[model samples]
Target chain A: MAVAAVRRLAATAPVPVFVARGGGTGLLPVELAFDARLRLVVSPRHATVLVAAGRFPGPLGVAVDRVHDQLPAPRGTLWWTADVDGDRPAALRDASVVTDADPVGSVVALHRDLCLGRIRSDAAVLADDPPNRFEGRGDHGQGGEGMMGGVPWGRPMAMTGDDRDGLALDRLPVVLGPFLPGFPNGLRVHAVLQGDVVQEAKLEVLDLGSGPRLDRLDPAAGGAQHDLRWLAEALRLAGLGALAVRAARLARAAPAPASRAALARLVRRSGLPAAWSGVGVIDGEDARARLVRRLDPSAPEGRSPGPSLERVAEVLVGQDWSDAVVTICSFDLPTDRAEAVIEAQA
Target chain B: MTAQAEVWAAPLLTAGVLAAGAYVVAVLDAAVAAAVSGAGIGRSVLAGPLRRAALLVVQQPSATERPDAASWALAPALYAGLAAAGLAVIPWSASFSVADVEAGIVLWGTVESLAIVAIFLHGWSANTHQSLLAAYRFLAAGLSYLLLSMFVLIAAAIPAESLQLSRIVESQHGLWNVVRQPLGLPLFAVVALGSSTWGPLNLADGDDLSGGTTADVSGRPRLVWSGARAAMLTSFSAMAATVFLGGWQGPVLPGPAWVVLKTLVVLAALVASGHLFARVRTERFVTVCWLVLLPLAFLDLVIAGVEAL
Candidate 1:
């Protein structure tokens, strides 16, 4: 009878969870532990909302009072799952504040590949804010009017789910170490003197296809405009702050070969836009491919061009047969052709 | 004796006494070596598989159904009796051995078989199942190698056609039998080991039967009997090395010293292997001797016999 009561108390919970404590014991503590544990384990999505708002682990009496008092005032559904039992401890309910709508666009997995990081023609930036819950109320099990601890319009991260297999997915492979992809992805030139001292050095970042590349300066010594913050961070991480300064000073009359080599490898691999241009035919069956021919004559006009290049057929300039067209050049095709090009380019 | 005969006889007598003394000393030396070997083996128990497995196999050479105590004494008695019988034909320079029989060759051959009895005692005397098993194995292996070893003697005998060791050595006034019959040395080695009991075969201590067959028997009796058994084995190996490995033929070292050194070397190697290496299963040990070594020994005898002709 006691075991049945504990299980019944656990069932009064808002969430449905099935568990068996098969540690060679009776069922009493298992039911009680589940009850105490769930109080803290209240849905993580709900906790995320509270955590993001910086309002979690509120004092039990105060939160209870606030809920009871606020219950009279009508509000959209909001909930707080708390355990007041003095006998048992609990795992905290997860909480997160999801603020922001995910923008829709082509999902580019970055630095996914060295060459992919080299694709610099199209750049997209997105901005987002938190989503607000509608019909919020304090108690969910009490049938307090609307969805609680959930983004009304946006989705939240899932901490646990009804795995189709009904088994916890704990058998994840351990990641032994961290990996760094393309930190330096493209080329840059630094002018130097006889002794290898850099008098002035300019870093050039360009789109792979068109022109309007970014040019930044790498000062040998610290000056007002020097971009040493990132270099300083690198030096601090590498334990070479003094050496960085010495090499920087040495770079003026003659850049230290060590510094130059390090800089060269970084600049060469750096993701810097090279050039940008838009060339294409206005209308055609393969408009993007026709455009691709104009931008990169090496692609050859004789063969059927892929979609991204086919869109811009109107201004096909003498056919780009060099095949030197960068991935961006293909991406830069008009929207319709861009999709076709991406499909067939690879 | 002629002055020329005296020249050889003088050294031969001196060598004979020294060789017998060394035979005694080496028997003690082998006992000390076996004890040291046993210690090393004990030290390796945790570090190796043999001690655990052998110990598990038998305790004091144990088994549910025990063999009679007489079976255990049988092999050692045979080893002693056969070794003594072989000693009977040696002649000892001009006159020292028990009986200088005319058919010394066949007489020596007959005594050599006593080693088979000695080997059987090596295993059987343990009175434990494993020891008995080892005894059985020793028998089978000895039978296989014994035939081949005798061929070597036969090969050495052909030039003189005399069974006596003295006559065989005499026929080699200008050249030893080995110069004529080279296979005698290797064949002798195989047969000597098979019969040595202390060799890889008898594993008389139940090389694989930890503690050993007589591991339980201790005090004066174990000491006396074990010492005698060891001496018997050492004696046979010494004789074989003396007979086939060019008994005392080397530059600088006196004939007696050379003979002693060669004998001890063969004896030391035998005891060391007995104490150190694990015992092979009975059937496998015999199969190897019969199928592999026995044929080779017989073939060598045929070749040496032919070459002697």
Candidate 2:
């Protein structure tokens, strides 16, 4: 009886959906914003329904499995692609699969079924393994050495490094997202951080299929929507959810003068421009300038294109995590085209 | 009722009230936030928090590899406990209060300080890069707000010549501190929001860190941590009512009713301000809080002190 009661309550809550963007799904953001039932979360740790949208290459298949295992028990996965379930677990083979053209609707339906107890959640795929095995190598499993040189728990302690402000601090190396919330889809960076400032950043590009040809589809309207999407994402990153939501709505309703004006007013009132003014620049335009240009319909033909991956790493090296995100989101990158360029160059 | 029984009963009663009030204010905050953001409101908004509570109750608690489980598990409960303890010094009415200590202002300040410690522990115990970064950010940014709040609290206490919250309320019989020290209320609101890590001041849980300290926390732990945050907001708004807006003192309504009403208004303001402004970066926020807000707070104190003299 208690279990049944809990399930009933859980079903009513918004579906915490972690969207795994594969290739370039242009409609995913618009679909996510259109539905109030779905809450697009950043981490798998906080999500229950994993929506794997678009086509994933062989390597990204492994990345999907890792993220799937990271979800807490009583979780589900919805594959929004053709035969993508080839790599998914057998338990999730049938009921959890959604090959529907409308991925968003399928996700909502799956969430509803899970909540109603119509389907049981998928079990953990990976074993409950500790991060590192303790072999009793030394006292307290320090690999026989004391604090100075031992690998504690199979990972080396962060060594001290000079920060941007000239202080020596422990530099923590972390990967900042292919799936991180508030970041460009499929963009990952291996960064060494000392006290929130990135000491070094190396771009890691996973070859997902071809990116969206946004310019080929109604370039003027598409460009406007793209700018709105950027603005919305930046606002969301800045912790302005309502404005982000409104901006996203305007993006969906692009080319409307009233909506454009409303979005512009929202941006100004949010103080986002002033807050982001001091961050590093892209193509001589800071985040504020990029945001302002995005809001203005007559500003330019093409949105200020994002810097190349190498240039991004260079610009991101000395910036704090917040500034890095703002800087990255400021520029519009044709990632699919860029990948093709790199292939040709090589 | 006997004095001993009353003493025990008062705290229990206040605790019950605060717990219930916390949930109500949380729901109201969600509704207002959703409405402003152009999301669904009305009954759906009310149902959102309840459903979240239910989901969290049934979900499993997760931990990162080799986390300090003891401290990590203890942090949320400790945060909520401190918020509850802070409520004891607030007078619901002249006769109805949990514990009206002589140094009530000091006690409340101590609670705020300890709440920060609890938050830092929550972040540190997670043993993840994001959580640790959030912990350090709070430590750096929280200091400026903490100092600013202390100065403003002292300013409110000056005219009353008392640290007792009830006395402070009594001191505002002629003119509330909102008028006496014009900058006191706004400055206090900013500090209250900053200390609680709500809205624009929510750097510890900002999108940059992907929910920051609470990134890895889920299920019941997330519920409790979030609840404690709402409770702390309630406690601060209640204190602000007593210190500046004249708590429980009103024309038509009874004392406790007035206190409740004023607290709700202050809470609404805090919630609205959180959604109104974009979150400033931590480094920039710290600079603004010290260079700009700190001096204004001191000026408010100086004026209050002179008035008392």
Candidate 3:
């Protein structure tokens, strides 16, 4: 009886959903953004429902399956694709498919069912095996040589390298996400990091299949709406979720000038400009400048398009991890056409 | 109350306050978030925490490719345990405290230091890049704030002439430390924010690193980690009240009531700061801590010492 009560109570909580946006997927679906019943989680581990919402071609399709397995038990996957009946990825064939213009109701219902054990949860697609062989010949599992030389668990251990401070420290090579939260969707950066600082970096954008985009459903949205949506994401990245939601709400509707002014005032009061000042400077303009520019609806439209994909690495080389993320997000990366134009080799 | 009853009630009180304070933090945070976002405020704010907890309880735990499972599990437990231990040293009323050790301030200091270890372990044990990066980032900045906390705490202890929290409260009977040393409470607020890793000082479990230390965590462990954060916020606020606002000293009502009321105010302030301020850049925060906050903390201590002399 206590378990039943818990299940019922859990069902009422907002469904933590991880949205896996394929290449060219613009801002979140307005329905998902507006619905309070759904929460977009940063990590797949924190989610119960994995919503694969775009065209996932090639390796990107495999990434969706990988993310699916990351979610803990009592989990489900929903494919929110345009061509529901036409063609679906083989991995997501058994998963629930939704082609509705507004799928918030479907997502909510699915979560309730998962919470109450109305359906069996999705199982892991990959086998529970290490991808690399543990080849350590040393007595202390240090591969063959010293402490930092080995592929212990299918991955090379961090090796010492020259750092910015003229000291030698262990440098760990990390490939940060096609699906990482707070990162641009489907863009991965191969970075060699010494401690929290990026030592060397390269950027790559995956060509997740291109199709009828989910977020561009309203093409009639003017430049104001585009700026507002970008402002919402920037706020979200700045750790201002409340302000982000308010910005998103404005983006979804025709806003009065008074509301926009009020939002600008709130933004100023929130100390965003002060906090972000001097962080991620590019061409004399910092993240703060980019954010301030977005707030002015009357500002001219021809903003400087940020660094191209190749230069992103140079921009990220010395930045702290968090600054690096904010720097990337601060750019106006025409996500819709980035893959086609900037296909640089990582 | 008899000595026997005092001994018995101490643990229960500490546990009860910790649990209740954590729940209150969640509710108050939700309310603040709603007000800021212009989201509708209603019964959902009150019920949101419990409902979320239930969801976590029912969900299964998740692990990375090769996580340090033991430390991952122990991290949250250790963090929450540290919170409870910190609360034990706080004097809720004149005649009541869990274990009012003679060196209670020293004990609280230990709690703040160990919190860094727990947070680092939580991030490192995950064996993921983002989590590990967060751990490294925290290690770099943790020491600066830790020193600031110690200096402010020592300043608060000066007027009392004893490290015992009860004596500190008693010392405040004549003049609260907040009034005597105006800089103490504001400086200590930094410690409370940093130690709990809340708001702008929350470099450890920030959204930038995809929840940072909590990125790969899920289910009950995630719930415990989050609860530990809230508990730390509460304990730090209670300590703030005890050291500065004169814990349990207000009149017209009972002693414990005053402590609770002051703690709630501090908690609300901390929560609001979390929402209002954008997270400081990690390097910038460290630079500010060392160059600015440290000197201010020293000045506070200097003022307290001169007053004592």
Label model 2 with its docking quality class: medium
Which rank order by DockQ, best down to worst?
Answer: 3, 2, 1
DockQ of each: 0.01, 0.64, 0.75
Please provide, for model 1 over A1-346, each residue's C-alpha lDDT reduced to its tens digit, 9 standing for 90 to 100. 6434332332222221111111111111111111111211111111101111111222322222222221110111112112112111111121111222210011111111111223321111112333345334434432222332332223221122223346432111111000000011121222211111112223222122211111112222322112222222122112122222322333232444454445423322221111112222233323234222322212223223333322222222222211112221232222112222333545
Q: How would you encode candidate 2's per-residue C-alpha lDDT over A1-346 as one tens digit per residue?
A: 8878877888778788777766545434533644567776656777778887655666565567667777765578876654553444332444355555556677766766777768887776656655575556655566534443345554555667677668878776677677666556566778888777889998876766653322223443565666666666777777777777777676666547876777678778878888888676766777788677777766654364467888888998888777787777666555543233333556
What tens digits encode model 3's per-residue C-alpha lDDT throughout A1-346? 9999999999999898888876545555422555577777778888888888767777777778778888998898888877654345555878888776577778888889999999888888877776766554765665635677577665667889889889999888777878765556678888888887899888887775555555553433455676777777777667787787888889878789789888988888888888777867777888789888878766756245567877767888888888888878777566543322333311
Model 2, residue A104: what's the lDDT? 67
DockQ of 2: 0.64
Candidate 3 is scored at a TM of 0.94
Instruction: Using DockQ, give the best candidate's number.
Output: 3
Single out the weakest 10-residue window by summed lDDT for candidate 2 chain A: A211-220
By summed lDDT, the worst window of 10 consecutive residues in model 3 chain A runs over A337-346
Ranking 1 against 2 by DockQ, winner: 2
Query: In candidate 2 chain B, what residue range of length 10 has the lowest lDDT sum?
Result: B31-40
Chain B TM-score of candidate 3 stands at 0.97
Q: Candidate 2 lDDT (Cα, whole model)?
A: 0.75
Better of 1 and 3 by lDDT: 3
